[model samples]
Target: MRGCLLDAGYTPDGVRALLGRSAHDALTRGEPEPAARASRDGDELGTLVRLFLLEDTEPEPAVTAALGDLDPLLAGRILRRTPEGIRAALDVRPYGEGPGDDGEPGADWWVVSDLDSPASRQDREHVTGVGGASLSLAAATVRRPVGSLLDLGTGCGVQALHGSRHAVNVVATDVLPRALALARLSCGLSGVDVDLREGPWFAPVEGERFDQIVSNPPFVPGPERVDYVYRDSGLAGDAALASLLGGLADRLNPGGIAQLLGSWLHVRGEDWPDRVRSWLPDGVDAWVLQREVVDPAMHVGTWQRDAGLVPSSPAARGQAAAWLDWMAAERVEGVGFGFLMLRRTDSTPTVVVEDLPGELGEGLAREMTGWLDRIDWLRAHERDADLLGATLLIAPETVLESASSVDPDGGWSELSTTVRRWGGPGWEHPVDGPAAALLAGCRGHLPLSELVALLSYAHDVPADALVAAALPAVREFVRHGLLLPVDGWPHPVAHRVAAADPAGPVG
Candidate 1:
């Protein structure tokens, strides 16, 4: 079956080239007319695309010619014979990436899941294929080689397929047996080996730990009711995500990392970061990035549309009212969705939660790893004296930008100065003139203590006062990759730094 699909040019790139960019983009938005027109030709690729992707029927002879011996697919209920012709009962889409020019390998495989459409809504157990959340988790996941990995709530096994390329062993779990069956089929089709388990949450993996775990769990915020198995956990509010976060420490080996996509409630008069931080367990470090937040109405509308409910329809309106009422009663002002990266650490847990809205480009895995490494480096030099004695260097991609305006006297005046990173997370930090000058001297040549002393002598300010104010900002810069320690710029080798100069502590 895989060979036949490949021979018929059914890969991701091939399909995009065949459908043309405009039609392919339309097909992704769930509009099939353009794809229907593009795949009108009676070729093998067209037959498969029409039969599977466009949800259109094909003549029996064409189906047979495109896929030899339809008996297996028919028996498996992947296809059905009708009076008009044969129609696809399932969705088998090509999914993968080719090796990159930088010598990084890639994956080439297919994903199998139940057919999806508003016109043909399935039951709660319906499994979905590769989606936005799935792709996001895969992209953000740390791809370093590991001995074992756990794919929690592995719907259709998309993460499991990606994990197989890096991990020596992969275990995937789902609460629904139906989901597990489809996940098994996905692995089989991809020619990858994954241990498929059936149970809810951590039940299937009890008493076991993994080097890494990745999940795009059912994180939709709603009442304690399950309308769809793929998006509902029957847990009130965002408790499903909370439960997952609380149990992560025990399931991860030392230094193990877990990356997940989740949604959390934003209550009135409450900080969202604090609400999420309360869910973390001890002996674990976490970094939460809130990508987006939506009001109650938008949240309800989005999920309702996902469930194939027309916004103007009576049923959708009724459900939306109930969902909104529940949110109002619970005091949920909005819902925030983002990525969570947690690590099992032996030392004190460090949690950084913030709103980072924008495009997170490629190499996210590398950037995330770098962030954690920086955290370790910062934790080592916690004291002011220790950090000041350490040499620092600015990141290569860091840039400084300033804005100026013409004053009434026809003279230019600087308005604001900001330091930003060009790649990875693209974080921006606003800085004052003195702080900017301090960063400019971080060329991996001298200790931060000396830099502060020199700046104090030049400005004629107390060195102690300068050191006191600059240490906090320096830590922030290092934490966010704007500044790097000379000894451990790229990776940390030791936690402790040398003592401050004997002349006297700058502060």
Candidate 2:
């Protein structure tokens, strides 16, 4: 492979810079190249290269000619670019010099996307990169300091770059050499130290555990992927994702967690949450924040275009129709997409499997890690201690005041509608009345028990009776957001739905 890379104009110095001594040793050892006998499932480079050969639909001549330029010593990768410059690299790439700003090692190479307009060969969908899924997942990552980090399916290396800022060491892996190069470039640009490895999910780092792991894996099942091919696993609905999730618990260290972004296929009559839940490993705390679901029609349209299938061409027009047919035939209700944050631990983790694409996911991801940091048994209850202590102060503008007098005749007076707050006054009931009498006594100063006792005593009633009577007012206060519990109380139904997705609207 190195010889092939050299033929492609890569240099030995380039190879040494990224692979280091171990990689060189593997390439030089008399032992069968781990990349050869190893399949896509292997942690060795053999598996990564095998996956490349298996997955590539590229013509043999192009691949063979590309490989002819062998330079085991130099960094080399193959990238296919559109005449317009838009490139989506396919091979495991070699590194070049680091970005001038810092001495960080250079990137592995490949072209998954070229600057060519979206109109170039096939999928007409807009191309997205670190700016979208990668960045979103990065922003949602747990900030706790960790000793080492793993970026599975590192792609352009965005997740690895994010991890570099926190972890002492970073391992970024991918099946594509081109992707490795791009990741290297990204690391170079960020001036971060990252060890680039070419292998599938836990492979290259076999037997190694990290305090943190983050991935924006190629979870977009074969169906709804971007035409970039680089982004999709090219596997059916959830196979790839299952492999990732099913395999994660073993890779994570105890107390360590992995944060990921992914796309899932929801089958009819099959509970999507349950399907995802089935993938969680025992004792691994998990949170699956489903952000959106696109119906068959939308999914088909979205993915066909992504594959560069032009709706205008007769062939593309048929392709689009076929996609729609396939989805409907499968009764594909929608494609579920979300972020999964998992931690390996002894405690039963609260797994929030939801269908949310709106503000809820953003808010949940932002706060959940902190919530996880503080809670012991997330699965045991939805209630958190912090929530139990939380206070909800009513806004001044929304607070209502009261002025009332009981009818002297002991008859109900006309119920008038008027909103008022406390006038500039002291501890008076504001207007002597049962409601006011009860309200004025509630000074955050009194313990609930004591306050109830006071109310009972003032009313000359049994404490139990007083509590029963005062409950309505308390309920009203809750309605007005005047008070709130700080405890993270468990919800009877563990699953909660998230907001609507902005793009793939679900019924």
Candidate 3:
């Protein structure tokens, strides 16, 4: 590799001149030969050599063009010149491999081979810092208007790097010092200054609260260890993630939001959402989106394979034993995966629980924004529109007060449909099961969105899924007068208010 650099018309000083100061120092410190380094299994030196010794790079002219003339954070090079090429470079481990096709074939040049030789980028085997969760949580953050931010268990510093752009001051914590060192280099290269600390959750940030806290903590509950320790936060059950949620209320600024991506053990015959709901601290308004569920066997099979535990390491045998033990001990049938959006306040608790039926990254931004908007709607709106709309639009078919009386305190009661055979003296029968339960309630009274929400809750399905599955039925119900649709929902009062305040919050 050294000779190659020299042959590529590059010398130590030339390489140093190419990169700024800090990067030069980082690179020149000590590196191994690419072949010798790649040969070693445990030594991290090989990984560094592979990442830093990039000579053939696909030019990012399009990316540069898209970035368009933004002034560089650093005038020329970030650091001073050195004998080595670059110091403290912001490197990407990728930890993944596959057909590198992402529209811009140009980007593939940046990733010639699978950079994530250690693990795949889409590696979802470990618990806390999985690919989708980490990147999504980092991406979903509303970067503007945050004063300070904290990232707990900031594996690879992806969260810290993202936060560094939006936050005035950012602090990242991890139990592993090596991870912190890696994160420091990453932040240095990204030109994002962050205070790096080493400690467990709350230990590092004691007596300190931020406007925002985002975590993709170790969330898996099983006992199997993987090559990368970055993903595992050691709690037996969902205890690690649950405790984080229960404890974060007091650690956040008033009206501050803390977004998390995690997994929870799904005990058979138990309501997963209800179990998870018990974890949120009071005075913290929360929106829970349950995206995916993996049964015990599938979970083990998938994670174990990704870790090279099975075919390579006899992971099949070891994982089978460990997972069986965990399942037997915890009586856990599966693991539920999702995202949590929470805000701490002094007011009464407001919880919105919905099945997301997907991965943490899918439509996560829209879901989070909708959650924030719903919180605003809840705080401002008083009388339930369902009741009003029922009375006015579907008066004959709607049981105006009966629906209201069904649940004295209801957040959003779903419409239940019970098929009618001609005319019966009393309501013929009540429906059952997920499908029956969700389809029974419309009675033509509520707005389509609210009705969809009700069905989504009842079926334990996603909002989008609920709409997709039930909209046709809903249109049928409307045609038959069993369901009613109202347009004046969500209060166009905002639109009117914005008439004068033209470039208002709403677009």
Candidate 4:
């Protein structure tokens, strides 16, 4: 059956192409699977699509032929013989493997979840299959080899399935029994083993520590109660997210990393960074990248739309108004959605808050881990004397660009210089003459002190004075990942420079 689905073009890109762009867009928006049956009616692919995706009844023979069996499916409640024809008991769709997941290319696994909003009977206990948030969290996870991983709120066990590639053991937890049951089926079908447990966050794994933890929890910020278990906790706005983050320190081993997707309230008159920072424990380094923010009105509307409620509906206006009023009463300025990467480090913790509205690309896990390692190096070597002896190299993705002013006398004068990075944080740093020279010359061949000494000789300046003038830029470059140690440079230094201005170094 899996082979049949793959051969019939049911993969992620394949389904989009088969449905055409517009219909694909509609399906993602919780609309019915439009044009699927119209385009491939009465065929094997169409029969499978109708039965699983569209939630439409098909002739008993067609479904049986596509599945190759009826007794097993019926016994499992995956298929039911209705008076009209054959109906699907669950939503089993083809989930494409992510870039770094432990699976072969072009592999598709059957993800089992409760029927979605469009096809659902408005059940509050919907266990989502592969949705946008699930995919986003999967992409953002730092995939390192680990002894164990905890997939908190593992609705369909997608994160556990992804983590099982590198982890020796994966423990998946869910609050809802149905979710855990379906997740077990999902893992079984994918040929993955998971320790499935039923409980609220952190309870099932009490007193347990993991090398990594991941979650795409019910983070939608709303009133104290909501019907949907998959997208909302009974707690008030953003508390679910805060609670999850607050519990990280106890659950993580030293140097363990946790990545999760969440929505937090942007309260009025409060610094959002500080708000998020308060949730982090004292021993963890964190990077909270805010991807999107929506006003209170828009936030409520988004959730309503996900529940298939439109503003035009009579009840929706009151619900929207009530939600907005409640948010205002709670002093919510806005709602922010993002990914949080937390690592339990023994050193003084560092928290970086930034905005990244762009879509995440592949290899983020490796990149995130590398960025954290660089931060460790920066904190450890904060002195010029310690940095001066280190061999430095410009990062590969860095590019140097300059602009000059044409003087009134027709002479060119350099105006400004900048170094742009492409691969990691995508930061562009302004550079001066000394910094530009450092980038051009520091190709991992010589120590920074030697490189500065050569520059001093070329410019007819004393080596000590040149080193003093260049220390600031050197520190800035290293902090931003533009400069790096080439060989053994981690030894303690006897002398230290007081400070380094990141603006640029004077030479």
Candidate 5:
């Protein structure tokens, strides 16, 4: 099957090129007519695309010619014969790995899952293929080589496939036998060996610890009932996500990392960040980024449409009202979706919860791994005196911008100065004149303590007072990768000198 698919040029890039941009994009939006028109040529690639992707019926002769004998597929229920022709009973789509760390090309593979259409969406146990959430989790996952990796709730085995490239051993678990069956097929077709287990959460791997874990669980928030097993956890209002997070620390080896995508509620008169922070166990460092928040109505409508319900239909409207009412009773103001990265550590935990500025972009795996390394560096030098004695260098992608306004005397006056990063999370920090000067001088030439003393002497301020004010800000800069430590910890990547003037005034 793999050879036949590859020889026919039925990979992701090939399909996109054959369908053209407009037809391919339309297929993504659930409008299949354009693709149907584009793939009606009855060739090998077109027959496979129409049969598996579009869920269209093709003549038995064409099916046999493209995929050989159909008896096995028929007996396995992977295809069904009708009065007119034969149609696929499942969805088989091409998938490709993203570029490696060295920017080299990656191999192509195939994934199998339940067919995606209005008819299949009604099934409560439906397993979905690669999606936005899955892709985001894949991109944000730290891809360093590890001894073992766990893919919790591994629907269709997408994360497991990616993990197989880096980890020596990969284990995937899911509660639904249906999902497990499809995931097994995905791994087999991709030619990767993954231990497939049928259990919920971490039950299948009891007492086992992994160096890294990645999950995109059933994290949608709604009433305490389950409508779709792929999105609903059968637990009340984000409790499933909370429970999963609370148990991660126990399953990780020392210095291990775990990444997940989840959703949480914003209740009235409650702090969301604090609520999320309470879920972590001791001896774990965590970084939580909330990407977007939406009100109850929008949330209800979105999930309803996802379930293949039209907003104007009676069934959708009735369900929406009930869902909204339940949310009102629960006092849910909104729902926030985002990513969580956790690491097991022996030192005091460093937990940071903030609103992410923008979308997760390419190269995020490198950025996330670098962030964890920076956290380790900061944890080792917890004492103020220890940090002050170390030399620090400015990150290569840092940019300094200043705003100015006309003064009362007609001369320009500087309003505020801000330093921003072009890479990683794209964090921006506001700085005053003295702080800006201190950052400009961080070129790995002098220790931070010396720089602080010199600035205090130049400005005639008390050195102790300056140190007290600058230490916190300096830690923040280091944590966000705006400043890089030079001596004690080895930097994750080599530094290049930025073209922008570090100390020059901005227009």
Candidate 6:
């Protein structure tokens, strides 16, 4: 049945194409899905759409034909047959990235969760279907093949589905029994085998470790109270997130990586970086990207609306006030949401916390992998002599921008130059004329020392002073991926091509 649906153009993109533009927009905006017209049309795909995708009742014959060998008991549990028609008790939709026009591979998984939004009856234990956060984590997931993987708080097992494609075996867990059931159904529907467990966080995998761990945990710094099992953690403030991070060390194998999405409370007069950094276990390489920060009032309203609270109503206003009061009492300044990637290692660990763009770009995982390698290489060659002797290449995505102000004479008065990386963990750095010339000349063919010597002679500056002035900017360039090591060994050895790409886009 799943394959048949795919054959008949049942996909995320297909759904949008079939529903027209306005209906597609309405569905994404959380308005009631525009399904009345499609449901009444009664085409084969439309019949299935009404019965399953739209969470609406369908004729008995349509239900029978859509699911050829569906178990009667399971069907009964999924739908309630009546004199007029059989109404669906569950929601099933085509889910995948969808194939690109230029022949790119897309997701083809069919996800099953409780009926959401307009179809929801406000079940406190409701398992959530696919949403923005879920897709964000999925796109951000690193897809290196692994022997074992763990999906904590695996709501509908979407992460597990993605994991199964790269991992030999996947273990997914959720505290809510209903969530585990739904995850099982979703994995089964997608024909991906997953070990579904009922436990919170790392409880089920207490002593076990995995090669990779991925989670889209319930990290909402809450109203301090909420009914949704899939969103609320029942813990005060960000304790749930704290616990999840603190325990990551024991759950990962050596060199194992964990990618997670979470929300942390940012209190007044406290450094957010210090608070988040304290959660890390010793000897772990960590990168924390603070994606967005929402203040108390806005955060409350957003979650309230998600919980079906209407903003203009007096009740909603009261709830919002109470939420603000709670945040105030807790000293919460804002709620920071973002992604964390942790690697367990015995070597000296590095921690980086910075604000990055909200959207995950293409090749982010590969970019991250490259970054870790770059960090390791930089850490090994920190001294001036070690760095100066090595050859450097401008990053492919790097572009040099310059602005000049005219003097009274109209010749070039002053020139300010900046080097910006065009893609792959984008970054920009200001550079002086000498530094810019040096970067432009160090194109993997010549050593940095030779370039610095030539520049010092041309500019009539001492070579030592020139290298000293350029050191800080050069370090920043390498650290931020603007400059890459290409060739010429620091030690007495043959010239070697470094690990980074040397001939990327020059600009």
lDDT of 1 by residue, 341-397 (tens): 999999988999998745876535656777787889888998887898999988778
Q: What lDDT tens digits, residue by residue, belong to model 5 across residues 179-207?
A: 99999988988799999999988999999
Off by over 4 Å in 5: 20-23, 31-42, 103-105, 403-415, 491-507
Q: lDDT score, residue 484, model 3? A: 29
Candidate-wise lDDT, in order: 0.84, 0.54, 0.53, 0.75, 0.85, 0.75
Please, what are the lDDT tens digits per residue for candidate 4 over residues 67-139?
7768887998878898999988887776655443333243346678877645362468878777668777776
What's the best-to-worst order under lDDT?
A: 5, 1, 4, 6, 2, 3
**lDDT by residue (tens digit), candidate 6, 37-102:** 743553566666767666666777776666655466255466677778877677776675433223
Can you tell me which runs of candidate 6 are displaced by over 4 Å? 1-9, 13-42, 69-76, 97-107, 118-121, 223-226, 402-417, 423-425, 487-507
| lDDT comparison, 3 vs 4, better candidate | 4
Instruction: Please name the candidate that would achieve the greatest lDDT relative to the true structure.
Output: 5
- lDDT tens readout by residue for model 2, 1-507: 444444443333533333345544564442324324332232223222332322323333344454533232123333443444212243233322222112234333321222222453343322334335654675577755689899887777756765665578889888777567666655653457799999766889999888888887766554544445456676666778887888888887888988888877788899888988988878787777777787766766675565556668797677677667767777777887888888888865556575442253333332455446434422332333322223223223323354346788996564442223222111111222444455454444444456556666776779776655545444434322232223333321232222111110000
Q: Candidate 6, which ten residues in sequence have the lowest lDDT sum?
A: 498-507
Model 5 poorest 10 in a row by lDDT? 498-507
Candidate 3 local accuracy as lDDT? 0.53
Stretches off by above 4 angstroms in model 4 are 1-43, 98-107, 119-122, 357-359, 379-383, 401-417, 423-425, 454-480, 488-507
Worst 10 residues of 3 by lDDT: 498-507
Query: Candidates sorted by TM-score, descending order?
Result: 5, 1, 6, 4, 3, 2
Model 1: pairs clashing at backbone N, Cα or C within 3 Å: none
Model 1 lDDT on a 0 to 1 scale: 0.84
Which prediction has more favorable TM-score, 5 or 6? 5
